[model samples]
Target: RATKSLSLTATSPINIALVKYWGKVHEQLIIPANSSLSITIDQADLCSKTKVELIPTAEGAEPQLRLVLNGKEDKITSRIRSIIELMRERTQGVRAHDDQGHTLTLDASELRTHSLIITSENNFATASGLASSSSGLSCLAFVLSQLYGVSESFPDEYTKFARLGSGSACRSLYGGFVQWHRGFQAIQELTEDSAKVSDQSLARAVELSQESMEWWYNNLSILICVVNPGDAQTYQKDVPSTDGMKITLETSELMKLRLEADLAQKHIDQLTGYLEERDFPKFAELTMKESNQLHAVCLDTYPPIFYMNETSRQIIKTATKLNGQGNIVAYSIDAGFHVFLFTLKENQVKVHEAMSVLPGIDQIIITRIGREGVKLI
Candidate 1:
């Protein structure tokens, strides 16, 4: 038999959620408690590049899988294993033409006869709450789909696969403005089938008018402020997001209000309108408010998850002070110390300067909003 080896590479940009996804309704399916919205960062500035290869294994040998992240050998987490198993199940009998124009067919049985190797690297910090998993897992899903010739059975089908690896990862599968729908209510009211629920939990790009797109590209800029340039792994949260969410749901009264109000969906709707109208002040206000609410919910959680440090608080104060004079800047922080500031290109320098002078800020990266999502190199 001819040596059948296949490989593919893909890159995905990090997506910073404006309307955050803090909790989960379904853990195994990675369903969110609330819908979320985000802007994809440009891949050139921050992204994860993932490459996968399948090589035939000896007839009597059990196929093995290996993963290397950022030049370090890493154990295949259960989440990643689930994504691979899903890809294998979905890609059975799928066929496509490779880059060399050779027709390739994927066989479920034969897939088990091959060893898989995945190498992924991120240009930015990981585990420090910069949404590195968003780019990392999305890139993994994209490369796997491309390699196996997996076709989307529904709209954003691949996004469902990405969501299996990380909830926010689904948003990274698209570019420009994207939204991850919270299908928990729909799933509960409908059916309990896992596959159906996964299908309903989807992320899709928000349609922006050509003018809005142009304005966003031309006028908007993001400043990523790194609070500490130390090893990102050291900055990993004491409380994992999943655990934090579970505690919040059980203990935080504010969390109850947040869910009852459907705050995330509301913010997404309002932000979408503000973006369309090119109303920076309204957009900025909503963005900052949502960020505050997310942290507040964290504080309300029993044992209170504290993802922000004093330096993180200082950045928020500085941004707020600057915004008092003019709403030229808005700050959003995820479950990490890094602060993402959104401002117009005209005020980029001013915003960067203010952030740079703040103590404990080690680095500030300037990049524009990304217009594309995961793509083959």
Candidate 2:
């Protein structure tokens, strides 16, 4: 059979989780203890573009998967090679036909024969403590899955692939209000069995994140405050979010106490209740508390990685103060200290004008909830 060509592409946005994925129960699989929620931003000039292509091979040569990164030929290391191996393992018996009558069998060894090209570019900037890595990696993984014929039912497989590349990539699989269900790898293991259950809870949970009916869609806007992009020389430094979680497990006695007393759930529910009431003060309080908890765990680490600096703190304080009274404005910080300020559309110009004057601030990009994830042309 003659081998044929194939290509796929996906553009993914950087998402900020409301109920964040702080710790993981299963590090290897990237499972989280609690669920997380996020909104996909459309503008503010941040995104990742990924393209995947397949080519036919000759009869005798060893299969090769060439990875060209940023227009340069790159070697596949052990870490990335694992994903190809897993893809081969999962798609062993499955057969895919190209435009020509050729059948492609995914063999671990033969992956090298065809070139798997990946090129990603961030719209605004890279390593400025922005979530570009997450969006880029997630977009690559998503594009590859589509090219390789993987289904969403195999989220663990795809998300695990993404997680190996970037910690937050897994959550990008869904759009609105996603949750990783931390430390729970069995969600994928039992998916086949659970699919038979009558309640269909998994379907419902997936629905919740993918739904477009969330309250903040039209009303909420986010302002991005950029700093020096955080030590550009330290680009793509591996933080290992799971490792951070392990450190939290050992040092954050509060985390253990919350787990034992089920306080995290109670606290999360309280925040949700407040959101239901449209109470900005309470929501802001919970968001600030959660950010503090996340950073506290970061501090609990041996070397103590500090994600939030003086500039980060100033933005937080100013944004919180500006959204005063019964107003519906809020601020939430992610793994990086970048502040994602949620406010009304009417407040956009004023917030931008105000942030422009702040010291150590670079630029502000305004964005709102993006439409559901889609394929690129």
Candidate 3:
């Protein structure tokens, strides 16, 4: 008998980049111009949970794709459609056990006749510069993979699908210190084909020594301070990230320097060393510098995009002040106004106290770094 339907649930943790991914080499393929490193935030504080149901359609009938987020129907974006189509094409005669332990064979032709219903929800605000898309898209990709019986044909194969949905989503597929490589040293080094380049542009977890992992788990504390709460609509960006990156790549002179110097790779290497040595001071310094440079590059753009507000500046000042006495905290901001303060567990209380007094702060969440990525539920 033909399988009636397949369903799976997945949860993914968001990641905050220390070595940020600011630009793209291939926009359609979502390949980055530079490598990035990030720590996966624990799901206890922030995450996206997604469930996918694939119901087979009648012969010759076009399958429908639907997405519901936070209990509201969301338009399935072109980026998302691309992921679904690609996954369907890639699904050959794959076999896997469903959630009920029933053996299922997923064929490409058979998958093409299935309609997908995806329902996702985030514990935190979406599009609020909190990496909600990363967790959301990654969770979707993971659940789809299970339903389609898609296995990793190559290293980080599943991440490739997630990357198509959102550039940062690739990094969210792994836990701990994850690095998303830019794929090639130079675009000229490879053929003009984007397909081959995308295969190389994937994310992997940076292997840390057991001792270092233990230290990180024991001491590291991530404090997320949401500047704007309530509705996600209020926090939408003036310029979408894709458009902002295009402007920076075209007009920002500093972008040329950033690419030529390969600053992202350098920061990744330095940060990795600092993490291994458990050098909090060097780690904090590098983290803050990278964050500053990212925003500076944005300012250098033609239209000059400003993601940080007065409240954001106040948080930076507080982190700096606290660091002056001792390197107790390092703050990193994405293309949004909220601040992620990285500090030791011993100083977490101090950092929280300082952040609480800051005006415009909505709420504070205290969580540790996560050691796992996307998981089936």
Candidate 4:
């Protein structure tokens, strides 16, 4: 049966992982090898705005998906197709009822047949090795969920559903300080009398950030230096992260040692504590160290992957100088050459001074963390 037309709009902010998610346990499911934490930057700075509509199609009409990113037609269609199919499968067993308990559709088959029109635009450059995919997919998932009334029926499926589009996209769905907890860690701590809940069925409050200290996240400033400024459309890694991880897991003995030491767990513990206590020194130290080790793991890969260049190393040096001058800035470089400098609001002047004088920096973007999460517009 044909359905009435419906549309929804949404915006989701980009997130930068502090404890990076470098490997995957299940690529199909997008399950990470370790839990990762991130800060939701200001929505006004970098975000993706999306509009999803469900229009009644002709009896034999096929689903139509139109994607325009940053005002240009791109090739992200296949990813969106996978997401829709996955969501449809999840909705298979679901039965939607009206106010009077009347079934809305004949069955799941009828619902899956419904077509959707998706239009998305990003505030920043997409496919440029930036976090555009994370934000765009997040916004898409949120809008799609609303169109399907998934938000009202099954609240827990939102992030998990968004994850199908992109792994880091799940973290973008939440605001403030968010962590995609690796479910396996739950096994080490639960009591005997506790329910037989797997990592997926754990119990915890949704908002991990404490309200009394929400202001802490708001005041933190992040300065992004796009050293590589690669095209997001083809913003691929010099060494594909997935391929690099496979080689690292199989060949790098350091990775095995790090796993044995529970390196990510240790980093998370210290970083979380430093964040809570507002210890800039400890926070900065661990951030830099983890960033270094992450790259070291990449280098440890069989072929020795390299994402950063000469200018990236220079940026790190400049950040250290800022720290020495009492500015207290911490820098983290991801798989790309982009550098994320974390500092407090008070040290923004020093940050400006240091970044402005630095040569070869294409752009220095100043923004904050712990911003409001995704929402309908």
By lDDT, the best candidate is 3
lDDT value for candidate 3?
0.86
- Preferred candidate (TM-score higher): 2 or 4: 4
What are the C-alpha RMSDs, in order, of all predicted structures?
Answer: 2.3, 5.1, 2.3, 4.9
lDDT of 2 by residue, 142-212 (tens): 67666665655655556667766566666666655454444323333332223222122110122432122
Model 1 residue 163 lDDT? Answer: 87
Where does model 4 exceed 4 Å of error?
A: 1-3, 76-78, 92-113, 152-155, 186-212, 228-235, 325-327
Better of 1 and 2 by TM-score: 1
Per-residue lDDT tens digits for candidate 3, residues 171-279, read 8887788999889877455444568788788899998899997899889999988886334447876778899998999999998799888888999999999999999
Candidate 1 per-residue lDDT, tens place, 1-377, comes to 22566788999999999998988777888878889999999999999999998877886788889999989999999999998888788775545555577876767777767899999999876755578888999889878976776745533778877888888899987778999988766323433345566667789898889999789989999999888734444777778777888899889999888888788888999999999999998999999999999999999998899888878899999988888877999999988878999999989998888888888887888998998899899
- Candidate 1 residue runs with Cα over 4 Å from true position: 94-106, 127-129, 184-196, 229-233
lDDT of each: 0.84, 0.61, 0.86, 0.72
List TM-score per model, in order: 0.93, 0.79, 0.93, 0.85
The TM-score of predicted model 1 comes to: 0.93
Q: Could you give candidate 4's per-residue lDDT for residues 1-377 as a string of tens digits? A: 64555567899998887878777666656666667777787889899999876555677778665666666766655668777776666554334444345555534576655566678888777655777767888888878776665665433567766776777788887777677776666324433333222226211113434742465665678998876543432446677666777678778877877766778878888787877776777888898888888889888878787887777888888888767755488888777888899888888887878886777677788888745777889
Could you tell which candidate, 2 or 4, scores higher by lDDT?
Answer: 4
Stretches of candidate 3 exceeding 4 Å from the true structure: 1-3, 58-62, 93-106, 187-194, 229-233
Model 2 C-alpha RMSD to native: 5.1
Q: Give the winner by lDDT: 1 or 4.
A: 1
